[model samples]
Target: MNNFFEVENVDFVVGGNTKVKNMSFSIEKEGDIVCLLGPSGIGKTTILRAIAGLEKIKNGHIKLKGKILSSEKINIEPENRNISLAFQENSLFPHYSVEKNILLGAEKNPDNKDKKVSFNEIVDLLDISKILNQYPHQISAGEAQRASLARSLLSKPDLLLLDEPLSNVDQSQKEDIQEKIKKLLAKLKITTIIVTHDSYEAFLLRY
Candidate 1:
């Protein structure tokens, strides 16, 4: 019954319109994957953004592991929250190769650098080893999505928010990628929330 992540009565407004109102939810356990299923423009992505500190919550609070991240009176900067949000849009640095992009935001602490997973290990886990030397523009959509996902994972966030993560993945590769990602996240014991429109995928993930 201990909640590790909590969103309490969060309200987000855009241009005088309430995009997200009175929303409350919690993730109670480490490595628990929660899927938000709803139609587009229903504030699902907005909720994720609010939790990650990308969007300001007009009312109420967001907390992770008992640390306050967002509230009406106080807001932590996105970078300091230690939460990584992978958008539906490809966020890769165009000039960086896939290998460089994935490692760009990794933890820089020298003390535990050896403990972190290596570039080769992540690329292999995401099944993106073959495209490591290629640029963002040189890769396919599915490949770019995989690389972006890898980049988010490399940051070693306390919480991970994925917005329609598998949208661009090929249908044939979707299930396999999902399984790999699910297994990897479980192994890392990272609390994650994934936003997707497909109910079937959500059911599969939640089950």
Candidate 2:
């Protein structure tokens, strides 16, 4: 796999305490999904937050495509790093319609002056076309998750960071939802990293 985002000996310290240990990993354009597989509170989300520039790394380096995105001496803001992150919740605007929220990121893009990806495509792909006129509060957790995925992808992000996307969905629907998400990601040729505690879900991502 060609290296895209590399984290070397990264550390996060706060209140004179170290949270993240000496961590090192590399994610690339052609790489398979790598799970951070560990128990809760082991700095998994910390790693993603650090990469997204939401948390400050006190040491080591984070490089994206050979460019230093974050380091001890320098820090790049989240929006400029092409690192699109979708949290477990709070990914959409409660007031704006689905189409508006999906195209929100395109406004910051240098290209796509007219927002090339049509709103209907995203809505249909996510199976939320009927809910496009509805607010975020009106959708199911699964529907909201799909909208979040679509929103992040519409940004044309280089790296995707998902945090337990299906955690809130029903157990019976987990496998099916994961399959759909995986298919959409493959279709888009997007580099994705999914953070989940389910072993079976992670196993399916190994391909």
Find the candidate with the highest TM-score and give its number. Answer: 1
lDDT of 2 by residue, 1-207 (tens): 547778999887555567987888887664345666667777777778888889888779998888898898989988788878888876798889777887785665548343345556666655667877778888888778878877886776667787876777777766766776676666655567777777877877644
Itemize residue pairs with steric clashes in candidate 1. Answer: none
On residues 1-207, what C-alpha lDDT tens digit does candidate 1 reach at each position?
558999899888665578988988999987789999999989888888878887788888888998888998999998788788988888899999998898785743224342355567678877899998999999998899889999888776778899999899888888977887787787777789999999977876662
How high is the CA lDDT of each candidate model? 0.83, 0.74
User: Model 1 misses residue 149 by how many Å?
Assistant: 0.1
For model 2, the superposed segments whose C-alpha errors exceed 4 Å read 14-16, 30-32, 108-121
Output the lDDT of residue 117, model 1.
Answer: 58
Supply the global lDDT for candidate 1.
0.83
TM-score of each: 0.92, 0.85
Model 2, C-alpha of 23: deviation from truth (Å): 0.1
